[model samples]
Target: MTQIAQQHANMDETLMLEYGKGNDTAFAELYARHKGPMYRYICRQLGSKQHNKAQELFQEVWVRVIDNRNNYTVEAKFTTWLYRIAHNLLIDEHRKNQVRGEHLTLVSDEQDEGILAFHQGKQEGSVHNDFLQQAIKHCVELLMPQQREAFLLRHEAGFDPSQVCEIVGAKPETVKTRLRYAMSQLRDCLQRKVGATEVGGEREI
Candidate 1:
């Protein structure tokens, strides 16, 4: 990595440490740096059907961060710690849904721009690409919750498998199996939608 980018990447831990020491400005900086991706993560987790609840949960995640500042440690990357909190909150939400007998599914309200950009760069024909996006989203919603979480943490949050294991509190092999199953399901579903080999028309997951 470039020296400048490396320095910026390291700032998250530094900012959180400062915040632990009660530096409000440091806390603000940390929030601003992370809020966008983190909020989107929550929104995608709940899907558009529960956007209002997603907003509440998003705020709660930050509130927990603020509440726990003094207890923060530098043992891991700040993003890892932050996402671990989110993972736990999502688990609570799933349990609540189960108790209420609500069918739980994770669908994106909109196509992820990152995924779209990737397809755009690699494929021609917008119409086919759009269909592919919708197919992928549909298949994702059908993933089992454990598999879906592992998939999103790896793809959406750009976390490596080890970091995903940490966030989800799963063994390395468990997380890997989840990811493998998710990819297989998505690929199989997409192939059924667009015909054989089309899953690779843009790029492999």
Candidate 2:
């Protein structure tokens, strides 16, 4: 592993212990380490609409971590346990909201602006990338709820296929299938939005 990864691996246990001992800085470090992945996972789970809810849920997750710090064990990867907490929070939120639609809005105005800027910068000479990213987001939004959850758990959260299976309570092969289908749908959608010609010459992800 690179230096940063090695450092993280070394500090994971120490951070957890420190946080459990009421060390706020340790908790802050833990948040800094996992926030992006957790936020992305929540964003994917809620589609783009849960932006505000995600923030609320994120804080709740941290609060749970703090409240239950003394109960943590090092048997499993801290992230796996952390994600489990997030996953449960999402389920509760979904139930409370009675969300029945497949299109969960994952992006807020702020995130949309950042995504737009990211694509725009990449496609400096053309609008293809911007169009492609928007199209992909739309296509992703249309995914079946389970498929979206599985795919995001695998990609955004960087979970292994087996880990994704565990998180989503599916078989490993099922998670693989979901990711495959999600990617295929996104590729087709991007190709259509940007046109086949543009897609042929587009930069690889």
Candidate 3:
């Protein structure tokens, strides 16, 4: 394994042990490491409609994580377990809200443009990068829930296909298929939007 992976493995064990012992710092460390990815996952799942709700749900997930720390086991990867909790929480939230299907709207006008500009600068150097970014987000929004979830887990969250399978409760082949379709759709949509601009530039999906 790479050094970062080794370190994360070691840290997971240590932090869990410390959390079991009621060490706040360890729990904090775990939260700090995971909060961004968890939040992003939730945001993507909810799309723009549930920004405040997703934040509230994200906090609730952390609370549950802390409350249930004593029951944590190291059999699976720490992230696998963490994401399982997140997945369950999301399901519960969805059930509570009776949320189904995808909604496409610009819910947050807050810094999306700035973030998109920065990301575009790093990826495509075109002047129309913001338009392209918005188009990509819209295209992603157009995906089926499972395809979007699988795509985000694989590409955005940096999970392997196997780990995504574990998190999504799908077979590895199923995860691969979802990812393949997601990418193909994204490529087609983006090509239509940006007119053959290189997708993702340095970041090979």
Candidate 4:
């Protein structure tokens, strides 16, 4: 990898260790680096229908980071540890919703601009591309909770299956199975939506 790539690979872990040492600037850097993707992850997990609740959980995730700085360790990548906290909180929220007999519902792509932008890519594409993006998001939301988490972590966070296992506290085989199923389901869903000719003809992830 290039020098910048190497730097970025270790930057999160370094910033986190500095934050643990009470370096507020380090904490700021860490937050700025991760805020967008982290927020998007929470919003996707909670679904856009609970935008307000996703915001609360997003804030709570950071607060927990601050409170537990002293307990931070380098056993895994900082993102892994960070998302683990988020995963736990999401589980708790899901449990509460379950007890209330509520299932989170997915909304339109407009519900989360960051995630929409992600699906849209960096530059604008054709109208067909836009429709495909929307269709992809809808299919992602249809996945079972565990499958969704694994898929998002792999695609959004760019983690490998082992890293995803660490983040979601699942075995390697389990994470692989989830990802396989997610991709298979997404492929089938997209094929049905836009026809098989358009499916797997675009991006791989």
Candidate No. with top TM-score? 4
Worst 10 residues of 3 by lDDT: 102-111
lDDT of 4 by residue, 19-138 (tens): 889899999999998888888888878875788999999999999999999888878778878888999999999999999988775444455444434544422345667767777877
Whole-model alpha-carbon lDDT for candidate 1: 0.80
Q: What is the C-alpha lDDT of each candidate?
A: 0.80, 0.72, 0.74, 0.80
Candidate with better lDDT, 1 vs 3 = 1
lDDT for model 3 comes to 0.74
Q: List the residue pairs that clash in candidate 2.
A: 47-104, 47-105, 47-106, 48-104, 48-105, 48-106, 48-107, 49-105, 49-106
RMSD of 1: 6.6
Q: Give the worst 10-residue stretch by lDDT in candidate 4.
A: 196-205
What's each prediction's clash count? 0, 9, 0, 0
**Stretches of model 2 off by over 4 angstroms after superposition:** 1-7, 99-124, 196-205
- Candidate 1: list runs displaced more than 4 Å: 1-9, 106-127, 195-205
Cand. 2 TM to true fold: 0.75
